[model samples]
Target chain A: MREFQLIEKIFKPLTKGCDAAQCLADDAAKISLKKNEELVISKDVMVENVHFLSDDGGFKIASKLLRVNLSDLAASGATPLYYMLGFSKTKDCDEKFLREFARGLKSVQDEFDLCLIGGDTVRSQEKFFSVTIFGKVKKWQILSRNQAKEGDLIFVSGTIGDAFIGFTKACESMKYFSQRHFFPTPRIELGKQLLAKKLSKCAIDISDGLLADLRHICHASKLDAEVFLTKIPFSIHAQKILKQVQDGGRVCSHPELVSGSKFTTLDLLSHGDDYELIFAVNPKNRKKILHLAKSLKLDLTCIGEFKKSTQKKFEVVLRNEKNQKIKIKKFGYEHF
Target chain B: MREFQLIEKIFKPLTKGCDAAQCLADDAAKISLKKNEELVISKDVMVENVHFLSDDGGFKIASKLLRVNLSDLAASGATPLYYMLGFSKTKDCDEKFLREFARGLKSVQDEFDLCLIGGDTVRSQEKFFSVTIFGKVKKWQILSRNQAKEGDLIFVSGTIGDAFIGFTKACESMKYFSQRHFFPTPRIELGKQLLAKKLSKCAIDISDGLLADLRHICHASKLDAEVFLTKIPFSIHAQKILKQVQDGGRVCSHPELVSGSKFTTLDLLSHGDDYELIFAVNPKNRKKILHLAKSLKLDLTCIGEFKKSTQKKFEVVLRNEKNQKIKIKKFGYEHF
Candidate 1:
């Protein structure tokens, strides 16, 4: 199908009820904010083989792309409003692929109450999708990473390392792992609850793993952090995988893991794509946060705390269950 | 350089002095809109070896990407504010290329009084750049293509077909053509003047060639348009190229043009990449618009008028100087 046909037949319907979209006919979209509201925006790009397998269906690829971008807004404590997509379709992306992609987008947009606004669609040899999301938050209420105060208790929502294990298992035809790897919850409600209840003012999403993202907060706040390995939350599946590796069982078949190296629990802490929210809260508000978490039915774990740093360079210390500092190399994934 | 180092050493400097950018430290950027103001947003993506030559320098590629996206905001009569960029770099994009790209972005951002707010940088096998730009316009003042009325005079800013000629000549190492093809002026001020003075309420930027873009307005407004070939403004260089093609001179060396076919004037009207503004104005405001154009030192041509369409599918008729209708096979470039 031609670009216009794909837009008219598949993408245009996604903007049906959005008056601001202007039926996707205008050159650009116009949006208005309430008097006391401010706009929050973020963009994320995903390549075909680098980010997802080429054989992955459009639905899975589209869902992961939108979810990761939504995670950014969730970290900012903003409500999702709209999104603009830039898709460069490869030769293999036919009408069926586009239809499924649009369906996936519609599913997420319906769940988040956001609509498509404007974007560009083109053809390329290598397929990649980029999304720019716009959300709204109360004036002066944006939660930033630099707001972490000294002596603040650190917390992370949901299970960690599941995505890493899921990625490994998915490569071996594991459905559960594939599902976990592809469909991540963005924690939008928890983000808003934390800000609205004044429970926390500092937060970052765990896209680049726990330690690396925590270091981002520490670096921004000009402080240091200490995280206990035992306190880090892990799912039943991830724990089983860790046990198998520790018991001299078959290690992960991933190229990076199987190349003359043993797979260890530390690998879980350093791998990314978890999409969970890690935040800092005042010690006084700890009970309130836990209570909020119980009401929301989310697993909120207190894994660490922020500390004052005398040195200019901030550091994140990971300690073992025995209370000994664990030496580490390579915090998380780094794209060059 | 690693991704973080590249961002810290190069791209982060582009966010300086933008309070909303948060020193490039946050997951998302926050923006506040004044009362009676609405946000205008647009996105454009350019792929190497497709939208541009792979050998093109970062400065030229960066400038063209921003300019094309800015043209969308110009069509909506919006004032530039902020932008988010998503770039996928190939192995060939070294530190020098990134520095040059940043420099080009700084040049345009300074001239346009805008700043980079947030973006993502990642690695890819094929390089591509996507930009999402944000601007502001007064409430109820956005120029929409669907607002054109019957008897509205069709107007075009600057010249047409220069970019096509430039594309052709640049393929043969013509410096003048290379400059024209690489750099385009976005008609922001003219769009603002038209809307502020109530001279027009309909406009579409000519990125998809003259007839194709005019058809966009006609399709949106449910009207037909008639453009006279003689009245269509063309630069001296474009005129020379057209004369050469007519006189059977050395035809363009572009692969598409030289493949057992004669390059004609119709190809010029059907080809795209000209970032000029095509708009509609009330006949009564023609003199005022011409006056405004003279003050701005821009050539604004009155090429045609919109007429009521009897059929469902709108048509754009091209008339020769002899008042005879000219047939065109393709309207403009389409990516499929």
Candidate 2:
């Protein structure tokens, strides 16, 4: 079957009750919004061997791709309503891969209550997955990184460095950490709570590690940031590994960084694929933000603080226990 | 520079004054719709070697990708607004290529007054371009192929078979046809006119050739159609090449079928890449549609009529000058 036929057979069924999808028969889909609602849009692309392992199953790849886009939506405190998928596959791709991909999408549809409205499937020399997610938020209620205010306390949802650690330990063991790297849980409800309740002024999703994404917020907001080494949140597994490295040994840590105090914290903060929310809240709202995090049963940490940029250079400073600035050779994940 | 930094340097400038874009710095962009407007969404993907030549200029590739998605929006009678782009390039792609690509996008932005809100740029093994465009239309004004009636007159905007003919003669010296294949003008205003004035009941953009896209319309509407071969519109250049083939010799035609009267019309109808609009209109509203077409300075042709499907098998029949059914060896472009 051709690409359109395959879409009709395998993908159209996923749009059952979504009137906006038009049963995936039209050239485009129509979505109507309420008077006070605005659309939150984002697009993400993943390539084989770059975003995921070449041998990864189709289901995992598909789910991860969609979830990453959802994570972006979650950052904006938008409820995802619809999405368009662009699947470009190599010539050797078979029907089984497509079926499993569709199955993966169905799982996301059930989990998020969002449906695919429109998309394209094309043949390429490489396998690629791109998704453009449509989300809805009340007018003027959307969160943005550029809205961060000076003196605002920087907060992050969930543990940091888990995904990076998982990626490091993939070959050895640490299946849980590895799975965290493979599948990320987007903080949708927490983001909505923060935005809807006006608890936070700015937000960003941590895909390029903590330091890099924090710098993004600082850059956009025309401020600088100072992250406390002791305040960075870590899961029990990540903490245990870090403790091991601190005790005169390093295993499954970054290969290039030398083992010890100089490299440990910065390494954890620079490696990416975390898929967690990082937001800025006023110091007065810290207690309420903590309460919301507790009600949601999620680990929230005040990792850093935004400061005025004297030189107009957006920067992130990592401070050791002595409150002295640590020199950083690199900032974060470099896409080039 | 890293990918995000490159984005900041190159792309952020393109989003000037588009408040919803957030300067392309945020993880997601926010857009608000008017009280009576609905969002029309479409996506299209293009890959090197499959969709275009590997050596094609970045400007052409970028413009083509955006235009095809715009064509989808046009078919739905939506005014183009914001778009998100996903660009995946191989390792060899450099700054110059990206600059040209951005210039190409600037052309479209200038033409349509649309802006890029958010997107992703990734490194892949092959060049891939995917765009998801969000358009606006009045509530309940979206057009679909499923609304065609049995007695509706089938009208097509512009000429047919030009792109296919262009593709066939690309190796030879047919610059006009070749350019037509590279760039297709989306009937944005004409589509809006048809939808707003209620001049047509159902519509589709002819991307996969006349016969194939017509099949899509017929299948959706539960009807069949009879297209008069003599009535199919053709450009002056397309007619010249076809005439050369009809003069007892076949040149630059498809290799699968033996040339002559049997294969000529079927081949032209089935091969795709023509980005014209094919719509169905009531016989009572034909005069108004024609007048609108004249006012718009567009060539609109009544090439066929939809018929009730006897056995629920949606089909298209091609008739010769004598009105005899012409057998077709193949349908349209099938991307398996």
Candidate 3:
């Protein structure tokens, strides 16, 4: 279908909220506040070779790019209302390529029902995809990274490591998991529900990974988290990846045992695009929130708890095969 | 001065109509409007090699990209409020390159006091820039090209072809006249005054050139134009460009002789980043509007009048040495 047609048919249904969020089909979208909502805006950059491959399928890259931005929206338990896109044109680009690019934009925008209010397209040697998403939260519903506090329960949605596993397979030319490395979906509904019911106090999406992204909250909130390594979510295919890493001359342990330093396989488990919601919920609302999510088709898991700052007191906690204490060196991924 | 410090200092005084704009410095900007304004958002893309050469100088390219967006805002007579930028990183691109780029951004934003809201940065092989400007105008003051009426007078600021001359010189390595091409101010005060007085009924920015842009207004208004070429205020340097083209090969019996079939010269007038204002003013307001602009230290010239139709008669009236009208071929800038 044509881009406009696709936007109308597939995407227009998603423009929701108070009168502030006008229908998304207009050339320009306007949001007029009915009550109290703070507009949250975030922009993310993904470049070819840096964020994706030039040879990567355009649709996948475009959708994943949108997902990454939407993941940011979920961080605040906000509804993504609008987005602007900036695409760098390449020499090989032409009208047809742009048409397809627009179509792909329509698809993801439609999936989220986001209004493609405005953006820029320009030519460059390498492609850069920058999508800036806008969302809104009632002042009370806003969950900032700095709002995490001690005694708050840390929770993550669904599975982790799938994205990293997919990335590893893509790097190794293992055809089976290439799709996982692309076309990641952001947990938009869950985020909306979280805000709607006041379940999350502070949250962020696992775009960088559980460790790296969680560190953002911890660092900003000045709180520390002790995640039960045994409670770490693993993909159904995680065992296969752990086995592959073990075959690559890395000492391994039973992942369920959570014992010993697992630095070698940490890369496979720590760094990749995971658009799942990572939220901190009040301990009192845990059961109610879990039940609410179940009715809303969202799976929830509590993985850890927050504590006072750990910078002054460093400790490594692990469990042996017999469930006794042992030392585990690495926690997660680092961008630097 | 440091980039952010320069922005913070210089932009402080020029802030316009910001009482309602959600000014988010170093984070994200937001605008919450009550009524009578439909947010107009548009984006344009620029890339090295495709939009400019390596020799274009980084600062000029950066300013030019921003100027184009401001021009878009200027056309709609929208209050140029906030802008978002997207950039690609290359191996050769260091913090130094970025500091200059950010300087250019801050300069433009400060000059117009256009808030730098948010943007994305990524690594790439060739430099690319995409800027999206957001502005708001009253529902009635939202001047669009399609709203011009027959009998409307087409007015533009300053002269048209200077940008083309500066462009040609820059292409030919000529030193002089390059400054005008580098920074064509977005006629902010002129646009706002026009909007406030509701003098400009319909408008489009003259990024394409007077002829082509006028053509667009004529098409959108469902009318044609009877342009008086002699009335146009040609810059002294444009006279030099006209002299060269005429003295070289474009000799004809008519003073308003035609050459350069693609309107490349006029295309430079109309084509890329000239931030001149093109508007259709009601015939009754012509003299008073001109007086008002003069009082504001700005120049406005009426070059053409709208016609009923050009569908059956595409006539180009070139003035002979005696000022008698003679038939000539028609041409203007091309947009794809």
Candidate 4:
């Protein structure tokens, strides 16, 4: 199919019920903001092999691309509204691939109540996708990373390290962790509730792993973070894998997955792709925050707290079960 | 440099003077709109060796990327505001290349009163760039392709096919047409004046050649366009090349540049990359539009008129200097 037909047949339906899109027929899309509302925008780019595996299907890639950007809005306590997708298709992207990709986008849009606005598509040797998502929040309720107070308690939603485990397992053709790796929950409702109740003012999504992302908050707020390794929440599967690796049990034949190698708990904390949110809350709202998480059926763990930075530099201190500080060599993934 | 350091040292400065950008430190950018103001957004993706040459400098590529998207806003009669860039860098994009790219972005942002909001940068094999530009237009002043009326005089800004000539010549290491191809002047002021003075209500940018883009207006408006070949404006350089080629004189040693080859006036009309605005003006407002163009020191020519479609399908009829009908086998470029 040609470019115009591909858009009309595969992507145009994603803009249904969105008057601002103009059926993707105009030179630009028009968006009107209501009074007292502010628009929040974020963009994320994913390249084949670098961000996602080359063997992954188009559906998984498309869904992950949108969800990652949505996670950013969730971090900012914003409601998903609209998104524009920039797709560079490789030679392997046939009509079937585009249809599946559109299906994935449709599913996410339906779930999040978001609309596709406008974007550009081109042919390229490398397949990559960039999604710029728009969301809305109250004018004064924007949640930022620099708003964390020195005494604020650090909270993380849902269990961590599942995505990292999934990534490693997916490389071995293991479907055990594929769902967690391919599909991520953006936590939009949690973000909205946190803003509506004025529970938190600082938050960030764990895209570059927990340690690296929390360091961002520390740097922006000019504070230090004290995280308890034992307090960090992990799913049952992650716990099993941790125990097996610690006991020198062979989990897989992959070089990185060898018994007691780099797949330790510390390494998991440094690996990314988890879409859960890490937020800062006042100590006074500790009980209320837990109750809020319970009501939403999500596990909210208090694994750390913010402290005044002595050297005026961002620092994250990880403590073991015995209260001994642990040394970390690498924080997380770096694109450059 | 790591991703965070690269962003802080290189891309962060581009967000200066824009409070909504939050110094590019936040997860997402915030934008607040005034009453009766609508946001106009357009995204364009350019891939190396496809939309641009592989040997093109980072500065030229970056500037062209911004200018093309700005041209879309100009076509919609919107004022430039902010933009988000997605840069996928190849292995060869060293620090020098990044600095040059940032410098280009700074130049365009300063000239157009635009700000860098937020975006993502990643590693890729094929260097590509996606720019999503945001503009603002009064709620009811947006010019649309579907709003053209029958008998409306089709107007084009500046000269056409100069960029096409530049593209062909640049391939042969000729710098004569480089400026026109690399640095296109988006008609932002002309668009604003057209909207402010209500000179036209239908317009589109000439990126996909004059005939192809005109066909877009015709298709969207459900009308047919009749363009006069003699009325189309051409630059002196383009005119000279056309005469040389038509008179059976060799213009260059390149195969395509040989006398009586594909480098004809009609071929120029079929090639793209010209960032000029094409609008439809009411016959009564013709004199006013001419005056507005003169005030802006821009060339505006009446090339054709929109008419009711005879077969209910989009159609564009071309006429030569001798008033003979011309046949077009192809419209313009298509990605797929």
Candidate 5:
């Protein structure tokens, strides 16, 4: 779709109170100030062949992950008001590139009335895009990465690791898991719905691997976590395929499969791909949180608990064949 | 000199409420609910090689031009709030590479308290950084890029294009113009101090060359402009060197140079170096604006007036031997 058409078809319907004929049509965006509430804004970058690849399917690459960034605002339960977009126009960025990227951005913006405010455009040898989203919440009501308590239970929303499995399957044969990999939905609905109600004192998106990210909350909160091994959610189809892979003689050589096995179904708990929420809630309020998730029509899963710092209980635990707890110091994925 | 030290030396000591340290040092930043203001946020990218190359003098590449991005807030009278950063650590990025980048980023951040809230890190074949800044302003005072009046006078803060010359000089000898090219002072003091009072009806940073950016404001405001050629400020040094170059035949033979003669001093004016404010003010408030600038200890120049639009006007007038207005149709540097 053309730029204007893409906005018209996808973005125009999403925003509110914007001077559409002017701001959306022009090169930069316009701002209107409404008082009360603090604004919490953030920007993140996703690079081609770095954070994602063209082989992953460009259309989905452009769209699904856009939701991943938007999910940050949702995690804070801040109403997304607008966005400033930065695009790296690479050689591979042609009509299709522009069309899909625009479509993805427009659809996400529409989902939250996140207006295209102002950003920069530049040519690069490779493709990349960074979007800054703006949102607001009552200062006290907003959740953060630093507020988890030791006694809180770690919970997640929706299914975990399905996206990772989807990515693997897509790589195996461009089939079956297109939607999972391409249009992985952000838990915006669940995130926004969870705001201000203090069941999970701390929150963040599962953008990086799950275990790696949980460590972020733990580190920030200055607490230790003890995730139950069996409670981790594994999709039914994924469990079956993984079993077959494990039974196959060649499975051990494939690191992901063994990585999956070494952790039992639980380390999949730590493996990334679950865009589901991984937040902290007090034991007393667990029922309330489950009730809230059900009311919001989002799945709620309780898989772990945060404990007071042990001079050293910060390990990812998995049950061994001997029924002993084995610690894996290296979690799901390591960052560059 | 180093990332951690820079954060400790410059940013750590800054006055912050109990929340700043708790929230910022963690993976996120926190805001106490005291302030209630409308939020106006934006993000801009400056890619390496694409936006600025090492040849562009490390320090100037570090500091000065980045202000062009901040000028967006100044135009809207929004205070500098916080900045989100994205830097790709390339193979070429050694300690010195980081030092310069950090120095440049620190200078701007210090000036604007555009606190470092959150960002991403990655490795690239090339080094580049993109920044997204968030600011706040009251509802009534916000400026839109598309809101110029029919007869509004177009004014710019300071002279246009010095940064442009510094850019060229940096290319010739990075060590020579490093001050001008690398450490571009973002005029934040002037932006914050003046626009906070609503002296200008509309304002925008002169990141792109003057003529094109003015066109944008005019287009957005639904008006046409008639800028005076003589009023356009050219630095004394720019005039001397350009005239010398033209006399020797270096510039005289080129149509691009000859055509852009009216804006010739543009190495300062037309190039994107001068991070000055280009804005439109209602004719009635011109005296008040001048008065406000004088009180604020800032330089405010009335470059030209915005006129009714039947057609576009070429305001960068030059004089021939007969002293007639010389035509300068093609305008300043085009980023795209």
Candidate 6:
């Protein structure tokens, strides 16, 4: 089928009743916001083999691409509204692939209340997908990474290291762990709650590992951070894997999982791909946030605190149970 | 430099005083619209060796990517406001490339009164660029391709065949035509005049050639088109090339320019990459649009008229000076 026909058949339904989309027949899409609301925009690009495995199916690839960008909106405490997808795929991609991809996109759009407004599809040698999401937030309720104060306590929602553990479990064909790596649950409600109730001034969705992303907030706020090693949250599955690595004195039995040798509590904290929310709150708002988390039924863990930085540069200090700093060379992945 | 530092040193200055951009240090950017205004959004993706040559410098590649999306916004009479860029490059792409790319972006943003908002940068095996542009238009002044009515007079802004001519001239090292192909002047003001003055109900940008884009309007509006070959506009450079093709009997001296052997007026109309404006108007509004065009100092040509389609599917009829139908086999480029 031709590009237009493919888009019409597989993608048009994604627009549904959105008048702003113009049924995808116009050169561009139109969207109008209600008064007192501002548009939040973010774009995320994912390339095959780099962002996802070459064997990943269309549904998984599509879900991961959309969810990662949605996580960005979640970081800003914005509601998902509309998005434009720029997709390029090799000739090997066929109608069935597009059908499943569109199905995955539709499912996410329905779940998130987002409409596919406009985008472009082209041919490329490899798969390159970029999602530009436009969401909405009350004018004064928007959150930023630079708003965290020096004396604020840092909090994280949801368990960390599950995605990193999932990456290691992919070799074992552990569907649950692998799926966790593929599909991240963006903390949209938690973010909105933090913003609307003024529970937090600064927040960042964990795309880069916790420590790395925390460094971003601290750097932007001109502060330092102290994270307690025992305070870091990990899923039961991740904990089990970490136990096996330490007790057996072996990282992984599978030869393909060579990166497992790098497994450590610190590595779990530093390995990227955790799409949870890490944020900062004023000390006075701790009780209120705990109550809010319970009411929202979200797992919120306080792992660290921001401190006034004497060097005027951000630094993250990892402390053991005795509050002694540990010597670690690498804290996160660096893309050059 | 790491990703964050790369973005800070190269992309942050593009944000300057735009508070909505969050200084490019946040997860997303925010934009607010004036009362009664709607946002116009469009995305265009360009892949290396497909949309452009692999050897094209960063400045030219960046200009092409941004300008293409701007053309989409101009088709709908939207005033440029802000844009997000999704860029992926191989390991070989260095700081110098980013500096030039950002410079090109800044130049275009300044000329269009738009700001760099938010986006993503990632590493890929090849260069892939996507630009998502957001523009604003008054709700009632917005235009669509589906609004064209039967008996509507068709008008095209500027020349049509320059881009196709430029593609052929690339081998001859002809700067003028090649530059036209590289840098298209989007009819932003003309589109605004047509919509704000209510002179045209429907419009489309000529990207997939004039005939192809005209067909898109007709197909969407449930109408057919009658294009007068002689009335189609052509730039002076394109005219000279066409004269050479007709009189010299030598399509091109360079073997690399063998594609020029396919040169014909019909070929010019059918080829893609002409980023001009094509819109449908009520015949009575002709005098007004002409006056508006004159005042705006833009070249406007009436090349066709939309007619009610009896068979439902749209068709384009190419006519000669004697009003005789011409047998044309192709309309435009279609990506599968």
Q: What is candidate 5's lDDT per residue for B77-106, written digit by digit as tens?
A: 777766666666665656665666666666
Off by over 4 Å in 4: A170-176, A251-262, B170-176, B248-262
Question: What is the C-alpha lDDT profile of model 4 across B49-142, one tens digit per residue?
Answer: 8888756787998889999999999999999999998988788988888898899898899899998998988988888999989999999789
lDDT of 1 by residue, A62-100 (tens): 999999999999999999999999988888888788888
- How many collisions between residues are there in candidate 4? 0
Best by TM-score: 1
TM-score values for chain B across all models: 0.96, 0.93, 0.79, 0.95, 0.78, 0.94
Provide interface RMSD per model, one decimal.
0.7, 1.0, 4.9, 0.9, 4.0, 1.0
CA lDDT, candidate 5, residue B236: 68
Residue B15's C-alpha lDDT in candidate 2?
A: 78
For candidate 1, the TM-score of chain A alone versus the native chain A is: 0.96
Report lDDT (Cα) of residue A150, candidate 5: 74
lDDT digits (tens) for residues A1-336 of candidate 5: 333354455445434446522345333344443335656566667777666776555566657656666677766767776666676767656666666666676776666566665566676777777776666776566767777887888887766666665555413442434465556667766666666565655787776667777877887788877765567666676676557656652122223354333223444545565556678888898888878877887778887778888685454344445657757655655444
lDDT of 3 by residue, A1-336 (tens): 333343344334333332322243222344344346666677777877667766655666777788788877776667777876666656565555555565666687778777655554444567777776787776556656667778888888877776765654423454534555676677777877777887776777776667767776776677777677667677656656677556663332423224343434455435757777778888998898779768867667887788887573422233434656544444454322
Residue B177, model 2, lDDT: 78
Q: Give the number of the best model, judged by DockQ.
A: 1
Model-by-model DockQ, in order? 0.87, 0.81, 0.30, 0.86, 0.36, 0.82
Q: Please report the interface RMSD of model 1 to 1 decimal.
A: 0.7
Give the alpha carbon lDDT tens digit for every residue of B126-198 in model 6: 8889988988899777878888888889998888877777666533467877777778877788878788788
Using lDDT as the measure, name the better of candidate 1 and candidate 3: 1
Per-residue error (Å), model 3, residue B192: 1.7
Of the two candidates 3 and 4, the one with more favorable lDDT, higher being better, is: 4
Q: In candidate 2, which residue ranges exceed 4 Å CA deviation?
A: A1-5, A170-172, A245-263, B170-172, B248-250, B253-263
